[model samples]
Target: MKEKMLSFHDVKHIYHTVRGEVTATENLTFTVEKGEFVALIGPSGCGKSTLLSLAAGLLTPSEGEVSRRGSIGYMLQRDELFPWRTIEKNIRLPLEVQHRLDSESLERARTLAEKYGLGEFLQSYPSQLSGGMRQRAALIRTLAFDPDVLLLDEPFSALDYQTRLLVTQDVAKIIRSEGKTALLVTHDISEAISLASRVVVLTKRPARVAAEHELCFDGENDPLRRRENKQFSEWFELLWKELNA
Candidate 1:
């Protein structure tokens, strides 16, 4: 059996605002196994982002437990690349922050940039790169530390439709190639379906697991190719109804 990398057992989170306490999730339970890709989707204001925050340890559950076996890397919606920093320096930020910027680690970061087609642009600033390239750089930065699991919070929502499609494919390919487990929170059902091996749907406010779908597509694992599958529309409609219902 695959070792579990992250698990949420009967988790609940309540935010204490001056207005009052607001529950975001209740009795949320799920497990992300080693190298698994799971996408989370739900209605607007359904606390989807909150789930990623909790998983990243940015917030603690008010009840139950959020357990993680290894380090987590978070990729936000915005690339969040420092405009003043070169792509190389941006990708190296994680190592520097962790105080692990040894020569070996720096070499590994450079190799990853090259391997992912950013070899020529390492010296380029974020402004010099396209949105997709910047997001790629952001991902490379996240991976520089070799985090065991990646928590993606709408990482592609900022891009144009075409760029979003292309970047999601690129991100999916890179994540799979590295054998990394990822938990993504996306409002786009199609995006979730294309990139995830499994989809977890949450209910409205005070979110809870409403449904789970295990996806299977023949042939290539590419997100673009997966979108063309007959089952893609089927799954999309199914999830659409689940979200609306």
Candidate 2:
């Protein structure tokens, strides 16, 4: 059996504001298996971001459980790279935060940056790189700590349509190559269909799983190529109906 990297079981989360208590998720349940990429899709204000926080342990569940078996890395909607920091410094930030900054670790980070075509740009600042490259650097920073699972919260949502496609391809390829389990929360159905081997759909606020699907593309793992598959539209339509219904 595949090892489970993360699981959310009957989780309920509430935000207590001065106005009142607001429940974001109720009885949310899902699991991300080792080396698997799972995309989460739902309507607007459906607490998808809340779910990522729950997975990352940034929020406590009001009810039930949130379980994780390994370290987690998070990449938010924006690249969140400090503009003043050079690409190399941005990548090494996590290592410093985790206190894993050492010659060996720094060397590994450098190797990763170079291996992924960011070597030449290491000395460049975030402002010096294109949007796609900034996102790439953000991901590498997240991976610098060697987290076992990745929680990507619409990491490509901020990019233009064309850049989104290319960045998704780059990110997915790197995640697969590194064998990291990933849970991506995206509003873009097409993006989800292209990147996920499995997808979990959530209902509107007070989020909960409404449907789940396993995607098959004859072992095609490339997100860009997957979009070209005939089945891509089929999955997209199914998900659209599910979300609308």
- TM-score per model over all chains: 0.98, 0.98
- Which one is best on lDDT? 1
RMSD for each model, in Å, please?
A: 0.9, 0.8
What clash pairs does model 2 have?
Answer: none
Tens digits of per-residue lDDT for model 2, 79-147: 999988899999999999889888999999999999999999999999989999999999999988889
Residue 126 in model 1: shift from native, Å?
0.7
Give the deviation of candidate 2 from the true structure as CA RMSD: 0.8
Error of 2 at 150 (Å): 0.5
Cα displacement (angstroms), candidate 1, residue 223, comes to 1.0
User: Model 1 over residues 1-245: C-alpha lDDT tens digits?
Assistant: 98999999999999898999999999999999997899999998998888998999989899999999989999999999999999999999999999999999999999999999999999999999999999999999999999999999999999999999999989999999999999999889999999988899999989999999888786457898888888899999999999999
What's the TM for model 1? 0.98
- Model 2: worst 10 consecutive residues (lDDT sum): 93-102
